[model samples]
Target: MHADILLRGGDIVDGTGAPRRRGDVAITDDRITATGDLSDWTAGRDIDCTGRIVAPGFIDPHVHHDEIVLTDPGMDCMLSQGVTTIINGNCGFSIAPLTATGPLPQPLGMILSNDAPRFATYAAYRDRLRADPPAVNTACLIGHGTLRINEVANLDRPADRDEIAVMARALDAALSEGGIGLSTGPFYPPARASTTGELTEMARVAQAHGKLYVTHMRDEGDRVIEALDETFQIGRDACCGVHVSHHKCAGLANHGLSETTLAMIDRAMQTQDVGLDTTPWTASSTMLNSGRHRQASRVIVADSTPHPEMAGRDLADIAAGWGTDIDTAMERLLPATGIFFIMDEGDVRRILAYEHTIICSDGIARGSHPHPRVWGTFPRVLGHYVRDAGVFDLETAIRRMTSMPADRFGLRDRGRIAEGTYADAVIFDAATIREANDYAHPTRPAEGIDLVFVNGRESWRSGVHSGARAGVVL
Candidate 1:
């Protein structure tokens, strides 16, 4: 058969946790037309992937790229890491259905920054994305925080029944407009006062639409177990799938808690729908004013609106330079982002190795010096975790980043390299695929991603973007 493009002679991992096999994949338009033993197939373009591995393109299930996708449609950072699709509006922040005017409050402002556009409705947001597509496919979840911001007049307390009703209506509208799920960040200031009942009510809206309820949880450190119970309870009460975004034990005191948390999740799964995603790194990034720095052993200033020059400096160094304490320095850098080093490496490995744990960047795509995960997460998993540390087999790792997320998020046709599926795939040398960026050089593209295709169109190739905006708003 004649095909638009042919990937010849590569070890296909297929993103199903199956063992890799040498094969050929033929693409016709935006779907995989054939796979395996296609040497006779004629194609307009033939790619020799002889010494590389071809797998479904990575899917980052948790990210805060609601605005970056529009601002930087190329999405070079994600493309270079072989991520062909991303689920944004994680951690309870979305830039849509916005009615509240003026500055965007703390964590929300951190998400949209100062210049990102706002949408009056989810439909408007989706329309804009359709009009100007990015380099990677995008799916979004309606944020409970955004809902609360629009409906609740007060931010320091739980939303009253009337407010809850209003938020529910907004959520229902967003879900009907194609939001894949409902996401909450009770951990953040905007939603910190939200009661479990309030969350359950909002989740019920998502459930009614047959979507998932994703959360960053109310707490991830001292009260994590309590938070997990609350999460499961909300899922049960709402009858919706619950997904924990960026699961981690955040404080030094909470080291090695994944053993307990994973067990808790396993038990919850028996009775309710439960899933989670986590990053490969130990350091977590968020707004500096969120007080997560208090739990961190060390903190680095990722970006500062007030002191823009402090982007990559250590918080302690900045504190010392200013002749003040860390807290004061942090306050001085108000409206900023910080990377907290609190997670134990052991816990990171345990969570990553968990059979059901999907991989995510939890990447906030703004800031002068964004977290390294934005540019390096997928490659780090392939190189450092899978290859060097032997966290899991390459096949399993691919499953976590691809099929698991696609299935969890209900993107039925996008995450496998088989016939009739969307042709979103990545080709790379497993031996050399490694993250090229770190905190020191946070924005560097990954090293060994040879080619990435989104909807059968080349988006990235050989360390450079192909400038193809073939992505769709899935």
Candidate 2:
């Protein structure tokens, strides 16, 4: 049979955590038409994938590409790492369901800059995505903080009953309009006042719609255990699946706490639906004003509007140069982003090695000096973790980056290599695939990702983008 593209003689991981097998994959249009022995299948385009690993394209389950997906649709940072799909609207902040058009509050403004366009409804945002598609497919969650921004007038206190009801209605409508779930970040200032009852009400709306409750828990430091309890309680109360975003133990005092936290998650998953994701790096990034710097051993100013020249400089150095304390320097860099080295290396390794853990970038696609995770996540796992450090096997790593997240997020057809699945695949030399970027050079593309296909179109090849905008809002 004639196929649109023929990928010949490669070791197919298939993204099911199964053993790799030498086979061929045939694509016609946007779906995998056939796999296995397709010697007789001819195609309009044939590529030799011999000696390379042909696996399902990576899916970043957590990211902040809400506005960049519209502004910089090429998404080179993601595409270069073999990521074909990304889940957006994480950490209780999204670009849509927004009406207030002035400056965004802290944390939200950290990711979505002050000038980001506002969409009054989730449907409007989704419509814009469809009209001007990005290079990668996206599944979004409705942000709890965004709901507060829309419905609640007071930011320093918990939402009133009427406010909660209005937020619930908005969340329900967003979920019905294609939101994958509800994401909360009580850790952020805007949602800090949200009580467990308020979160439960919002989660119930998502639950009614059969969606998940994803969270950047209220705390990931000393109070992380309490935060986990709160997350589980809300999940149980709402009867919904729970996803922990960027599961980590911040602060030196909390080092080695993943043993306790992962155990808690394991115990909860026995009676509840629970999943979590983590980045491969030990450092975390967010707004400079997040107060995470108190726990950080070092901080780098990722971006600062007031001091544009300070990007990529250490916060301490900036403070010293300005003849002021770190806090004062930080205050002057309002509406800025910082990368904090607050997490322990051991904790990062432990979380990434967790059996239920899905790999994600949690990348903010902005700033002059963005976190290396944006361009390095998938490859770092594949090369550094899988090959160098032996954190997991190649097949297992592929599974975490592909099918595990796809199944969790309900993107069933896009993360597998079996027949009838969407043709999203990456071909790379397994031995050489590794991230090229680091904290110093954060935007460099990854090495050894020879070719990438999204929806049967060659979106990236040989370190160059094909300019194929075949992505859709999933």
Candidate 3:
């Protein structure tokens, strides 16, 4: 008889790749109560959505918000982009299931802050999140690197049989405590020495619990075909779904190789369930690794340990200033992060245009000069790719950001605008929506996202947070 909020007069894109229709949405508490012609519906508040498009709140499937969610519950960067839910613990860099005894390893320490709270067990971490949730809902995967750091002390050798068994036990316990799946970044130093047998064995633990197996793959450049084969073999050997993180072909030598890699994914999907997520940008950013920087045409220092003032400078310039090679400069900057311009524009577009491709920010919520994708990913897709370039229709684009990711991660009730579903939605002026963030100004919020609702509560509206921390851990 009564609605908590009424969104009246808008084209509803239900996020099912369905055609938009003029309708109104009625929300009662945290669930959508009704849709279509709610002119007579009485509600506590009315949000005029005239001449705007209302769709399900976006889902980011690849993000590293594991520690920030605890440190900054507001999560304003993601909320401002209409991202209601985020899948954290990506790229084998989760912040939990480790004892607080030893030093944090590479890449993991880079993503998390120095003083992040440590949890001895995965269940303890999930319990803490449930008690004090962040502004956006979060789902997590247990990173293989997390297991390695906790179980195996050496980085130069593969885990022995006993170590593998111990890792498997930890993974099974994490899944039992509500981890969605397992993720590995074999390209990173922490997990580079992990053998295929070690990964397959742990993936089987996830598969037995009906969870996912996602990877950043072993390589993305010269040996990409071999990496693709290894990824597919892991999925088949473990008997579970496989997801590729930030799918792309890197380096000038591999400029247009996404065509080949994507085809390989399609062929692999015919035999096993496979999907991927990508940031809609031509540049990729990550921890400072010599191998990555060697292939990149331009490498910008995002954050540095030894030289704190070198955040926004180019790596080459820093080397020239020091009268040494770029590699030597990088060594002086010992623990650092960088934005590498290596991906091809054509490859980025083709991947985003793929039907099975899910949109993910893969955004890092750390550093002074963080990648622009952290703030601009979702809007960039809607504005630059969909609205400007006509890469895909609006409805299709919405599906990629919303239902595609929700379905991939098993968030069954949060991706569509219909009765009996969670009222997580975004209202925006489709014509005016665009990303304002760039590499130099990475923290700027997007424009034209008028309001964002998480679980029927107005989380963000008109460039300000409403101070409502109503999000939950899923």
Q: Give each model a TM-score.
A: 0.99, 0.99, 0.99
Please, what is the whole-model Cα lDDT of each candidate in the order they appear? 0.92, 0.93, 0.90
Full-model lDDT, candidate 3: 0.90
Task: Name the runs in model 2 displaced over 4 angstroms.
Answer: none
Over 1-474, each residue of candidate 2 has an lDDT whose tens digit, in order, gives 999999999999999999999999999999999999999999999999999999998999899999999889999998899999999999999887887667788787876767778889999999999999999998898899998987778888999999999898889889999999999999998999999999999999989988999999999998999999999999999998999999999998999999999999999999999999999998999999888999999999999998889999999999999999999999998778999999888899999898999999999978889999989999999999999999999999999999999999999797899999999999999999999999999999999999999999999998999999989899
The CA lDDT at 431 in model 3 is: 97
lDDT of 1 by residue, 196-257 (tens): 99999998999999999999999999999999999999999988899998999999899999
Better of 1 and 2 by lDDT: 2
Top model number, lDDT: 2
C-alpha lDDT of residue 267 in model 1:
93
Clashing residue pairs in candidate 1 (N, C-alpha, C atoms within 3 angstroms): none
